[model samples]
Target: MKATLILVGTELLSGGMIDTNSLYMAEELNKYGIEIGSKITVKDKIEDIINAITYGKENSDLIIMSGGLGPTIDDITKEAIAKYLNKKLVVDQDELNELKEKFRERNLKFIEINTKEVEKPEGSVTFKNGAGMAPAVYIDGIVCFPGVPIELYDMFPKFLKWYSEEKKLKSDEILIKDLITYGIAESLLDNKISDIFTEEGIDYEFLVKDFGIIIRLQSKISNKNIVEKIVEKIYNRVGDNIFGEDSDRLEKLIIKSLKEKGKTLSVAESCTGGLLSDSFVNVSGASEVFMEGIVTYSNDAKIKRLGVKKETLEKFGAVSEETAREMVLGLKTDVGISVTGIAGPLGGTKEKPVGLVYMGIRNGNEVEVEKKVFKGSRRKVRERAVLHSLFCLNKMLKRK
Candidate 1:
């Protein structure tokens, strides 16, 4: 099956707001073996929306639209869809009552303007919005969702369930898996698995994320063994670089590995601030393995808190391997990780440059420090440093 997505919002066109709903919808549809042929983004203008709808109706089997479904005057998606489909706008009494009840439960006044949320095209199937007041509308093959992400997320499942039961869409049994890897460049990875990617009935997508690179493998064949064999072939070629699959996060994996081994970790940060610590702490049950995290940004703080000598700071500066090693050594844990870097638009010397980072990991009596120069803005540099530190820590833990 083929689908087209129309995202309607002036804010999205003006770069004031990002359109992430289309991505979610595309992924969801692809899971059902539906291919997205086109994605259109239009302003809140009714004319533009109508044009997009006309185009979608002519070219696509299923049209999904998101945005401009609100109480505000600029919310014209329902009107545009009604005009395109030659259907009259009618107020859904049940939806209107639900909206009114929601407002009354929250002790908020329900003005007449709020009634717009319950208005739908004639003969359209309306889905309840669990997250907000705006109801989702489906007419013919077209589906409309609220601009709000939370509302769309909540309503989409119900819509999908209804469509599945009503249409009885056959599943193609398409399967997609994301194999996440770090500490390797995309070029090298592609070169290593270049031959395997060309195999029939399979597709590959290489996405560079903030944490690492993700290799998405999709299998058209329904057989589980065939998919596993294809995955095992890719694994045999580049298994060492693969960390986890699908939604597995590097920090969560590290925490899980540490907990499994009954090990604890401590961290000291300089240029990355508390980002590394924040990543680790975001995982549930991290307190079982995470002992402490210290952000020693200043030389005095490094000396006082992490036991870095004043002489070491004077000779090697804060963004040095020596300083990173000392910072890690200061913390007492089964594993100690430290990051020191120059993530800067300024504060770079002739010898030391911006994006220069030093990460140190102390495991038992063994200590390892790696120096790298990343390229990006200050925020990007710090993020890369933190991710690299986690990658190093993961490797060290795996070795132990």
Candidate 2:
């Protein structure tokens, strides 16, 4: 079943707060065979909440609304839901008793605002909040949750389990192995694998990174034993370009390579800034193999910090194969990765249009440099550069 997520908060709309809740919810829901159809952030207005909730109910089978379940005047999620369901704001005696017990456990008295939290919409099911005082409400198709992420995270699973069972969805997926290939365009890859996906009644997802692509095959099936047979058939067709299977990020594979080789890594980033470092560090055990990361954005920093040659910068500009090679050569560490690129909505000349990237990797005495023109926005260019850098490093690591 498809679900809609609505995040309500004036803080989120005004950029006073970051909405991390929706991102986490979307990924988790996808794993449970529930697709996230729509996600939006609305203000704390009661009318806005009611309108959003009503609209979600009509289009989506399940609506997961976050924020605005507090006792403050701005906390209008509960009231808006009550108004939409045409139900009264009746005080829940069981919830009131629980509130009193909680306050007593804390050696405190129950206040009026806290009493307001006990007022859930009539005929609504309350998912008890183990973490906080505010309870989440589930009335028919709609599940309105507390704005606090900690409380919402704890309550979310309980509701999902209940809803998934009611909807009779099996949490099983067909697995297929992908053959990874480099130096192949997406259009070409699709032309090759499109027939296989259709013949097997399977779903395919591709993640393009650095200089390689990861193709994933998934199918929803009743029998678990059929996964091996289907995977073998796909491998027979496109086994040359496949890397690893089942959503393995390139950074993760790079980390595994470093661990296997017993080697350390350092990075010198120019146009990509610290984005590449951030990606590597996001891995759980990065500290084990990743030694250092430098964001030498300016030529002066590149010369002073990474010891890039002045003559190379002058001869080959900041974004050049010479400069990228020098950035690696200047590295004090044994193994290094370098990315020099122009990620631009601006600052690109006719000769050097936007999205020109040079990624280089040093795996011993041998160093390899890849020069490519990526096409995308500034964020996409940076992301693509990082992916390519990791891919190059992964290949070099394998040769070692």
Query: Which one wins on TM-score?
Result: 1
Per-residue lDDT for 1-400 in model 2, tens only? Answer: 7788999999998979998798678656766778778887889998888788877887888899999887789888888888888889988787899988888988987888888776878898888889888788888788888878888889988887887787776655433444456656878878876665554555677756553676755556553346566567666766645555655667888888888888788999998889889988999999998998999999999899988889989988999999899898877666788999899989899888899999879987889999988899998899888877877787777777
Candidate 1, 1-400: lDDT as tens digits? 7888999999998989988898788777767777899999999999999999889989988889999889898999999999988889999777788899999998999999999989999999888888888889999999999989999889887887788777776555778888898888999999888787656777888989887899988876465566687689878988888888988988999999989999889999999989989999999999999998999999999999989999999998888989999999999898889999889989887789888999998888889999999899999999998888888878888887
TM-score of each: 0.93, 0.74
Model 2: per-residue Cα lDDT at residue 227: 54
At residue 368, candidate 1 shows an lDDT of: 96
lDDT of each: 0.88, 0.81
Query: How many pairs collide in each candidate, listed in order?
Result: 0, 10
